[model samples]
Target chain A: MNRPKEIFMMTFPLILLLGVLSCLYLESCSAKKEIQLIDSEPYPIEIPKGFPDIKIPEGNELTKARVALGKKLFFDPILSVDSSLSCGSCHLQKNAFTDLRTTSIGVEGRVGPRNTPSLVNVAFNPYFFFEGGSPSLEAQSLGPIETFHEMDFNAALLTKRLAADEHYQKMAQEAYGMEMKLFVIVSALASFERTLISANSPYDRAINGDSSAMTPAQWRGKELFFSDHTNCASCHPAPLFTNFSIENIGLEKEYQDKGRYRVTLKNEDIGKFKTPGLRNIGLTAPYMHDGSLESLDMVIEHFNVGGLGHKNQHPLIRPLDLSDHQKKDLIAFLHALTDQDVLLKPEWAP
Target chain B: MKTIKVILMALIGLTMLTLQGCDNSGCTDPDSLNFDPEATEDNGKCDFPNLTVNFSYSVDGQELTKGTTYTINGTAISFSDVQFYVFNPRVAKDGVMEATGETHFISFDNRSIEFEDLTAGHKHMLMFGLGVDSTTNATIQPSDSDLADGAALGPQNPSMHWGWDNGYIFLKMDGMVDTDGDNVPNAGMEFHIGKNINFNTIALEIHTDALEDEVEVTVDVDFAKAFTGIDLSKDYITHTGDFPALANTVINNMKTAFAKK
Candidate 1:
């Protein structure tokens, strides 16, 4: 046993070497890979070269995952109290994101007070609600969710349900990474909605110098729409087609219902409703807040007579006195506002 | 052997020192610190006096009691509920407006004990008006399914709006009045008061120091007094035949009434 000490020394180095090597191997195995955070696809969100950024909250840039999830959630009736109604129920894809019914039906066969508005180009709308009560798309998302006659789901319950779902968890993580929250869900939906820009309409093409986009009647209608006699352009304007302000438009003197005044509590705002954009006016039929007018011709006739004889009627509303031909031309112009790309999109289909 | 032991001890000591340095600089002990040793926390308590204002009115000869239901003309009318909202109501000591909190939205629904939550004095200016404001009106859409259960007032309940001519019935005053010879059974009037873009407002003031417990105040709004300047005999009719004419007359009438109050 003369070499016992030497033997121990040799074995010790071997053991230490093996231990260090194993330790290095374990470290290598446990180390995480670098996350490849790909930048989301850039959209044409940039305003025209000279135009200022609209003084509104910028919606988050759209992502494929978020848009996909939003589309799913939009079509899912699970958001309703009874799981019977979805956003798509009221905003059908066939009618360019508007329902044909006069008023939308909600949960438990409940009826809403106003006509279901179209969602096309809703991102460009500065204000929401017929009376412009909510200022942003983010705020508007919660309107149907909380209304007793609509979805009727408690916000807290919705949060808890979403938190529990593994599918939603994955979606949320993909859309927002680690910053996902209930409010972020709303933001993502709004972002997805903003991507629904219908700028490829025939009218847009014609305005952008495509002569073949419009017929002669539609061209004449465009002229009449902007003319002093029609005065439609005063409220409807160009591009997005709305002035984004409240006007009485002479529907009534006193309504049992106050429109915009409900938000402000000001007496002066009585009978005032938000002037809706006329883009895709052909598709979003059963017109007006109450959906009283059935056809485009009826809408023209109503405006022609200066609306109901209410004291608060907008001064801009006067007898158009358009001939039948002019009215048909105006109708044709309205039809040209329809975007084929938007209508045919498979993503929009429920 | 002794040298190896000493070297191992030194290495251990170095490791311990490194750990100590990390603890001091990097890791924080949340339980070690003390917070706010001197200040008393706010427990949301209020100590204020009380006040009351008794309202008495005589129609013809009979003195009106608080809960008495009376038939005006023929339609039954009564003060179902009454409370006051002092827009910018404040607590005051002596003659100065106090910085203390006051109560607001003193209504039949939200009955809070602390009038100080609304205002802080018996000698408070009582500005009052009748009818639901515009903000409250939009919430009550006629087609809203919730309204079917009578949660919101709409056309089915009273048909307040003159069809669609007037968007919504703003104010509803339902009471019978002496018309022609006989007291008309259903002679009632609804003042759907709203204008296009003019803010119509009413104000009234009262000074009170009468109370024993916490100061409680109530303002009496007389519907009869609301139509004081309005001639019931001529302007008041059962049916809203001339909508534009009636609307103009009512708007002017409401503005005058509010201003006077």
Candidate 2:
């Protein structure tokens, strides 16, 4: 009887000790998980071969948390004053991030003046927007938000709103290592945009010595594009396919929008617009600064007619007189620039 | 103890949330490259794309100040006040010209003008007008501006604008004319010159000092030449009434007034 009672007393204390140890371990695990959230690792960007050297801006290094936060901000309609439209509303990933509307509708369904250009490979561009008003991706980031016809939300209100959200706070703090700031918000968006690089296309492959990749029709179109007669390559060159220059293509005899002239305030620059990259031209249709043209055929026809003459019209943009067959071939060549990496990549897709 | 840790973490997060709010500060001028939108306080630190140029009035190589006596078109006059309006200044560089959209005021007190937010690093020719040009006066209404843009320079309080229909008085030269060349009391000649047709764009016959960030140059205004050929006997004032002779006299003489040095 004495031996059994002593055993029971000793076992009771051991049982209690086991229970306390398990509880402490569980608590420690939970606490460690919280700390891990704060020390989240930076994201990695694997630059494709033969692409332009990417320069990540100072103090805005890429991180998984930053990219994830940016993607969320991009898709969130809370940016708009009415919560009806997000940046992604017009910039759909499948259609090369264009709304296809003649002019994209903004907050309260207000129609914008210019066409939404595809943002693929925009990291290589030094200037942004159709008029090239904004200098960097960071500078261009704030324009749409305050533009009366676009997002139409005040910056102060946006900062306040983002700060109040618990999820945004964690992500922003994790990514930027600070609370919600305008710089962090815009920088995050631009960092994600920097990741939106499109280099994998049939045209890119052809340029990389895979001659059999492009069809014969595409080859003919390529020749015409580079030839002095067309001289399309002078502005839209190979690789990135943009000279990063603004020019007047003689869209109309008299311009209403005034294009780059408004930014530069030079009369000679009137009706001039930044030459958009031709990386994914086929996917991003309804072209030009105003989205006035409905199809690639119409755009080619405009160039073929040499564009109604204007004082500031580019010297090389005279009549092409390309045949219907040549025009079709040119379009096939344009279609050859479909970037599968930008389209089907899980990281880029919505 | 675990519950206490969770509670403490939550409190820390809440404190951080309270700490970070909108604290924006930057240039407020919309025309500047560094325009900040979220700035709540004016901060009075607005920066503009500006080039500095100083205007100095002189007659026959002799600089004149307010209450100074000088000879003009054979009439010796003592200028009590010499104030003028400088219309939008156009800067020409490398054969290309660009204009600042805003107007400016020039007076005895304010001889220095900063051409806000202009192109830098080129040999530039700065051209300005004596008064508001007819085209601008007719198209851009002064009352239409919100005043926050610093538009309509020196309006209302300084007596630049005469009336809504009459438009702004581009140049106001008030003084007493002495026919006998005596520095004594005489008839007052208020040359309030302004009209759409009377607008004169003065091309300063001087070049900037390879204008970079900011360059200071003297804009010489010849008071004598400002009335080269006007019949003082008929009318010495050109205010609201259509005194073409007086207007023409001032416009013709005002040609040689400005020179950048």
Q: Which has the greatest lDDT?
A: 2
lDDT of 2 by residue, B46-145 (tens): 5444567788888777888777767655666777778888877777877777776667778887777766555544535778787887766654433232
Error of 1 at A65 (Å): 3.5
Q: lDDT tens digits, residues A1-350, model 1?
A: 75999899989999999999999987776542112232355434544322224433443566676677677778888777777888788888788788888888889888877888888778777778887866567657766765657787654456556767777766666665533344555656676676666767788888788978999999999999999989899998877777877888876556655776665556677788888878778888899888878999998888888888666678888787889999999999988887877778786777
Q: What is the C-alpha RMSD of each candidate to the true structure, in Å?
A: 15.2, 22.6
Provide per-model DockQ scores: 0.03, 0.02
Query: Which candidate comes out best when scored by TM-score?
Result: 1
Q: What TM-score, to 2 decimal places, does chain A of model 2 have?
A: 0.87
Cα lDDT listed for each candidate: 0.59, 0.74
For candidate 1, state the interface root-mean-square deviation in angstroms to 1 decimal.
Answer: 12.8
lDDT of 1 at A284: 84
Total residue pair clashes for candidate 1: 28
Cα lDDT of candidate 1 equals: 0.59
Write one digit per residue (lDDT tens) for candidate 1, span B1-261: 999999999999999999766542321321112222332442223223444333334332344443455544343344333332222333343455532232133333432323332233345444322333444433433322223322223222233322222223444444444446344433444444433332233444445552334444543434454444555645563222224345455444543332111
